[model samples]
Target chain A: MASLGSIATAPLRAEREGDKNAKSIVFLGLLWFAILFAVLALVVLLVTAFFDGRTRLDADLITQYSSTVFPERAGARAAILGSAMVIVTTAALAIPLGVAAGVYLEEFADPRRWYNKLIEVNLTNLAAVPAIVYGMLTAGVALSIGLPRRVVLAGAIALALLVLPVIIITTREAMRSVPQEIRQGSLALGATPLQTVWRQTLPSAIPGIATGSILALSRALGEAAPLLLLGGLVFVTYDPNGLMSGFTTSYRSRSSTGRHSHSWRFSRSHRQPLSCFWSCCCS
Target chain B: MECDGVDVYYGDFKAVCDVSLGFGYNEITALIGPSGCGKSTLLRSLNRMNDLIPEARVEGAVTFHGQSIYAKDVDPIEVRRRIGMVFQKPNPFPKSIYDNVAYGPRVTGMKAADMDDLVEEALTRSALWDEVKDKLKQSAYGLSGGQQQRLCIARTIAVRPEVILMDEPCSALDPIATSRIEDLMAELRDDYSIIIVTHNMQQAARVADRTAFFTALADETTGDRTGLLVEYDLTNKIFSSPADERTEKYITGRFG
Candidate 1:
């Protein structure tokens, strides 16, 4: 406490007085500069992304989908709803399985067992696996399962596999932060293993596990590759009405908005597609 | 309750070796030793609490009432309920004091009608009733360190275990707090059998009926330290005229 007071009361050292405090002050300034730079960059990007097409955006933008022939009729409603449905379904598919696996590993598994050690190592490697790999894996599994190639469920399945390892890891990490003493106390009371975990461990880890799963889901939401594999990048003039129906993402459709209508200054014929998508691509 | 030829290990690393001790019924036994002597490890093994550690392995038989607790049919959870534990640090659940005391009984399927009485009896037994009675609904974290430790004791006793294992329960507390806990131990000695692992010899002298002295055998070259029990006797004899020279040195504060 005395040393802290001395440091706080110390005189400002700058320029020729180049002491450790001078370096410390400079480091603090650099930290502020770094923070401001990151914040400013994000603000600029968000402003452009939101307001760039804001003047032309309306209820129709959220109620319709892109069209190949009529640019004025094109909207991003299908894509927006598609992403939302896919994310929600992804969370449902992933959270339960991840939490179960984490509880088993943290609360039950014998670490000395070779299989348990293998699982620990594999989860770390899986978290780093490329999103595109999951996209390919999803494509194969979806085809094998006889699921429609382009659907919200297939997109969600891809993302669930992508984020599963992360949720398990985070759940384990969260549960681990709860001191072992709590578990012992619960068990010493003669609470069954499942009861102890359900009553004590899981309750405490809920916030941490929730935070981790949210972060993982957000990361998955930003990923377009898996969704693209499910034909998410294509232009759809119709909204998805079922789990197996085709869909798109606003990532391209919103930007694709005003492409041939208001945002364009060039000849309209060059940007507008024919009603047939294949020939439109050929052209 | 007794363990015969008990050896505790973390994976292949032997922490404590070849320890055999019998805990007398309704008595306080202090397991005293320096750091790394595995007194805590042995205490944990008695109630099958060591099984919680994935790598921790306990070899040999730990029997409670003539039944080997390590037998496949003997559930560790059931054993833990029969033998409770108090930890070095005061770790009350982030719960109301009333709920904290009720947690054990609630899980063990105690009748709702009997719960209020049980919580009160446990708190009163631990000498924390008067202070916390007004704030039973308040969070247990609001209590002082000494009070939290006592609350933990109350929580443990709420289930009515036959034995209680205390691993440095008073070390985190002040002297006054330590004395309060020691006095509580003396009062509790007529009911539950207690096995306490303590670093304070004076504390052992004050509260324990029997004292077991442990020491670590160190291999300087390999840097391996394995704990072994040096002596076990009546507390007075161990403190005054110990059989082993090492025990005498340790008791006199002349041993490293």
Candidate 2:
């Protein structure tokens, strides 16, 4: 009780004692410096990118095609469409499967089983496997399976695999966050273990699952490294109409155009806003 | 309900050793002990709730009526259905009052048609229907702490379990709520066989028909701890004249 009371009043006494300590002020300043350091970098990137691409912030940026004929009329319409399709397809493939795998591991899988232990170790290591490796794997599989190269399906599949581990891990964490008491309450009421999980634990974990899934999706969306390895749809001039339609990502359009077309490139001297605008969006 | 030389273990460490007790039909039996005494563990083992813990295992015979519950052929789900429990905290599902009580029956494959009557009877029996009946559609979380516990009890009883195990059910509740629950327990004593694990001696004396005293003995040399059942008898007799020194010390608040 005395210790608890001391803890309650400790802050006031701490500041009084801290008044004469110059090290404390330095420590506070160092903490603020650390905070501002990170914030400043992100702010600078966004602000510079914003200023450089302010003129290209028009419907033309999204609606125009990538054109050698008329570079100004060139828009990222195809890439935007392609990225959206790939992300949607990736979500469709990953969400249910990842969440299900997560639920299985957390709720049912026994660590005593050798196969389950192997899976547990593999999940952690799989999350560390580079996204580009998935793209290469997708490419090899697509070639072996006689599927066409450079289509939206290839990109979606690669991204889905890339994010699957993340989704599973997050879903497991989310489900784990639901208090065990809830499970006990359900089971104590004669509900089966399956029923307890389905009715109580899952619903309670949804908010956490949603937050985790969105973070994983956003990270996948911003990625450009994986798309580089997949075939044909690198720089498209038309909108993606289907899963098989040839397409370019918004990042790919800017990067490919910048690499091949030097005159339209956004070098330091020539701060072409549309090219930098896509870079900002990707970051 | 009876357990013969039952021992509970978590992994290789024995939590409770050679514990035995029998509960009478339609009686409230209280298990009182300090922390780490495994009173809660013994309570959980009664309905096979210990099966939920991966490392937990039990030995010896635990029987409901004449049938050994731990027998290989007996379905644990069926055992749990016959013996329900209420936890220390009031953990109502994040659902409406009606849905919370309706959950137990619905999960047990009881028909939806008879659910209304069961829910009402459960709530009334647990002394929560009058307060919550008007807003059955409202979230169970909106109720006060005491009210939520009664609702939990109502939900537990909705499935019509023969025995109810309570693990410090009123520990989180205030005095008023605690008293209400105590009153409800007396009313419930006519129908349900109850075994409650309580830390409070007064609560055990106030409500329990029979009381079992438990204490954890720690080895000084090895630093190993195991829970032992000290004494059990009529509530009055155990309180007034305990059989074991540990039980007498604990009841007199001198054991520590």
Candidate 3:
């Protein structure tokens, strides 16, 4: 009976092999086409940027401040500084808050509760809201209370609102990747929940949190729509020194301590978050 | 030590029902049954290890040295500190071999000098001292499966718990490792009250002073499954001449 069955199925197996080889050929063809298309699009973008603006791009272009009536002399120094300040402050504020919230939601919170579901849904929606809306809210509410209008701090709070959901989502995923057995082992050894999370869970989840925070900060750095409403200039030679100094500084300083200290610290820290931020804004 | 009317439940489903048994001081008691017989569940309930699971619930009383473990305000952590556990799969932490053994003592706030001596004593008792002494700082994950299981045994001993609960400690090991662990169990009975759960009947016959056989029953109305203790006696008598027909069938390998 076994020999008869094998004879009957042999030709079907051979035919199936032929079909598999044909399907593989089609899959490889599609893969090559995708790679070629991606390369072509990248080449087109680089070539166009070079041909259209190459002559105008230089040190003077970066150094000179913008005049509303003179577009040609407008530099990106103030805009760059504004972007930097907002991103750094946002990261400083959001990472701890978002990661804590994520940890609570994933590890500690009971999903069956109504309030947790509400928070989860609201965060998802907040992530999708337009950046300009956050800017308007920050300018109207944050500035009116005590934070001066058009300073980096207000912009930071706005950007933090925009990127917090991303950090939370990524952090939750990272925390989830840690095996349940590890947590159980720690708890079984008589450690409290807080101790287990702080000692075992957090250390293992750090690499994931760092990667997510970097991605969120990069997105915040390149954002201009919210910053436009939050009052970032195209060019300012001097950097804002700190939150207080930036709020008080006038529009016409040749050199600000904020830029000097930031540049110095950037060179010193050499960490991925700092370098990645530099690449985002400088490029 | 006695477990009085102990019942374990997972959400709405009861896993083990109305089990009452006593383990003598400095004696080994083995709970043997087929797969899905609630032997492991009953074993975990002895030390309150099932508390780690979100929905697992335990009722009734487990007493250690005549003190009730399930009383209100009894700290589960304190219970676990007094009653240690070793699991089927060797789950040594991703730490050095020295750290693995030292972890329990450190948590209880033992001084460094005492911890050093305890680590050495525990490792020596488990027969793993010579194999890992030279590379005490190496990661425990680098050790072979048998060595890792023995390291777990050493880790449990370092805390100096009054009772040690083991759940299929030798199931994942080879025959040689199994023999070593069996030997260790025999040696350990001099100081600790040992309760072991194993599917291997021969292991229970060899190392256990008292053996309890458990079996599952299905409720007629609800069709819910729950485990019940079938028989309990001296290890030799239970194997050679069981009181119940079910126990005889299980012992003879005719049915489980």
Clash counts for all predictions: 0, 3, 0
Taken in order, the candidates have interface RMSDs of 1.0, 0.8, 1.8
C-alpha TM-score for every candidate: 0.85, 0.88, 0.84
lDDT by residue (tens digit), candidate 1, B1-256: 9889999999888999999989899999999988999999999999888887878999988889999999999978778888999999999988899999999999988665778899999999999999999999999999999999999999999988999999999999999999999999998888999999999999999999999999999978877799999999999999989999999899898997
Per-residue lDDT for A1-283 in model 2, tens only?
A: 4776556543544546644579888988999999999998678766766775577678887778777566555677777788789899889998999999999999999979999999989999999998889889988998999998688888888888999999999999999989998998888877888998899999999998998889989888877767778864556777788888887775333333455433122423235455456544543
Candidate 1 clashes between residue pairs 3 or more apart in a chain or in different chains: none
Which model is ahead, 1 or 2, in terms of DockQ? 2
Angstrom error at residue A29, model 3: 2.4
Off by over 4 Å in 3: A1-27, A47-80, A245-283
Error of 1 at B185 (Å): 1.3
Give lDDT tens digits, candidate 3, residues A1-283. Answer: 5676566544533445654687799998999999999998667645655554566577755566533445445455554565566677889989999999999998899877999999999888888888889878888896678767667777788788888899999999999998776676665666567767887788889999999999998888766667667665434555666764342111222222324222211232234453446534643
The complex in candidate 1 yields a DockQ of 0.76
* CA deviation > 4 Å runs, candidate 1: A1-16, A19-40, A46-54, A64-74, A251-283, B11-13, B219-223
Name the candidate that leads on TM-score.
2
Which pairs of residues have clashing backbones in candidate 2? A64-A75, A65-A75, A150-A231
Residues A1-283 of candidate 1: C-alpha lDDT, one tens digit per residue: 5676566664665546454577889998999999999998667645554554465567765666665565555666776787788888899999999999999999888887999999999999999999988988888887898877778888888899999999999999999999877887888788998998999999999999999999999988878777777666466666678778777655232233444332111112333332123223322
Collision pairs in model 3: none
C-alpha-based local distance difference test score of model 3? 0.79
